[model samples]
Target: MTLPFYLRGLLLLTLIGCGWLLWQDTSDDLDSAPTAVVARPTEPAAPPSPVAATASVVDLFPAQTWTPAPPPTPVDTSPPKPPPLPFTVSAQWRFENQSKIVVLHGNGNQYTLCNRCSIPGRIVPGKMLDAHYRLDKLTDTTVVLTYMPLKHASTLRLDTH
Candidate 1:
């Protein structure tokens, strides 16, 4: 059976490619044949001249003077402060029973916060609610939140809307 035209052409090309590669490898091996190494006599180093002998020690080898490093920069020893509060009071309500509630709209969510309570969700991971933040106080027009980790307090005024 006769092979298809495309198959015959492919076989011919493969054979030619393999032969070319073999030829290239053999040619490279012949060209890289090792040659003999020839050694030349080495002369002794010349002695230093009078001018070089009279040169200053600093010229031959630089003098390394002791330089006192700049005094260690002062480090801040104060305790770290908490980051700014991300919440803002959007609305607030107070009942006759003295209970207060506020709607805090921040970070794209509304938090219904009551007096002396922790905010829902975490401001930081791996921390208790009280350690992360506390609703320290709630007034008719303002809310006080204390970030216990750094003892930082932030006040948000309630808006009528």
Candidate 2:
């Protein structure tokens, strides 16, 4: 499937970031100073101020403890699956126009050809068929029946064998 331009750009940026992170070094400079040597200062340091050894505590208790109610059960909001494909290759016959149309239909969908009357199967318009063909092959004479959702309209390919 063709990826959108934005998605392709995002993937490219991710790959570049990963490559940079993998090759970059993060070590600190050890030659600059040693911890023991740096601890010995040339000048004397000032004394720190005195602080309380322990903090005072105050007790304030609630008369009753209330438990929070559990969150409401999550509702299922997913969309229902589309109906199954209805058409099957009951028989393959060569039309007189020297073209072949694979007919498919579902319980509610109807299949129709450019020239022929609406067949018993699901009828998808031409544009939707084009989108399906973008990722699949339907030219083989061997009828492969499958469930397909008709979502749009376009010109059907009559020349496909």
Candidate 3:
């Protein structure tokens, strides 16, 4: 026969052969056997090593883990205080070459007394002036009066203002 006829016959035979194979019974194979198929595991087989020096959750978020130090302790930022205020002196005069008695003009009065004087005695102020206080330090311009029992002191100056 011709080459074209032979080629056409070959093509027709190939199509018929493929169609026959596809139409054949796969039911026989299904009834024959079923091979096993294994499933993969999702987790690791071993635990992590502690000595590996792995990065930690803290390391991942250093900013979250970090904390700022407390603010520095507050410094004392007030003036050296004027001496404790108990009483104030307006003027004072010491007897010539004598420390025993001093003449003080204050609180609109003249008081004559020794270094240590008690309440209702000197030119001291307040109803509590009965509380005794001693002259701890005295100058021409100022006087430091100290309560002997309490050890608390007040500075009195020449100018009440």
Candidate 4:
């Protein structure tokens, strides 16, 4: 009489698989079939020119050799400069007698300087271990001192503001 429900389902699945395989086989055969080619008219080839036949091969852009640049020159790195002058022109003023005075402060001591003169009591205001200083020039806002033995000049500016 009749197959069970599970057997019927299995038979239906087998039939579907066989049909799919047959379809794939026919598609492969269609793809492998020869295709027809249509002929087209072709132009006759021209003979090569005599100049081109005699021309030698030449490279328009030649290969270049790479070369590394020379090492950079050594910088002239001089030693660190010495510290600045310790003395500063603290105050400057002119007396009624036309005498210019410059007050210098250094090392916890105040030394009063006059134009073309050393500090009172002959104490050098800008004295250092390596250099001695003498009052060189005086201006309204600047005091210039000459380094002794070296003759190097240094200026001290007063902060008026």
Winner by TM-score? 1
In the range 45-114, model 2's lDDT, one tens digit per residue, is 8675344322343347836658887899999998645443334443344566544556544344434333
- The estimated TM-scores of all candidates read 0.42, 0.26, 0.27, 0.37
Q: Against the unseen true structure, what C-alpha lDDT does each candidate score?
A: 0.70, 0.45, 0.56, 0.69
> Which model is ahead, 2 or 3, in terms of TM-score?
3
- lDDT by residue for model 1 over 40-105, one digit each (tens)? 859877888877777744566767869977899999998887787887767666666555677777
Candidate 3 lDDT over residue span 46-87, tens digit each: 877775646453465555546788899999997555334544
- Which ten residues in a row are the worst by lDDT in model 4? 122-131
Q: What is the C-alpha RMSD of each candidate to the true structure, in Å?
A: 24.9, 32.8, 20.4, 19.1
lDDT of 3 at 100: 36
Ranking by lDDT: 1, 4, 3, 2
lDDT of 2 at 63: 66
Q: What's the distance in Å from true for residue 65, model 1? A: 2.9
- Candidate 1 regions exceeding 4 Å error are 1-63, 66-68, 94-100, 116-131, 159-161
Q: What's the CA error at residue 18 for candidate 2, in Å?
A: 99
Better of 1 and 2 by lDDT: 1
Better of 1 and 4 by lDDT: 1
**CA lDDT for candidate 3:** 0.56
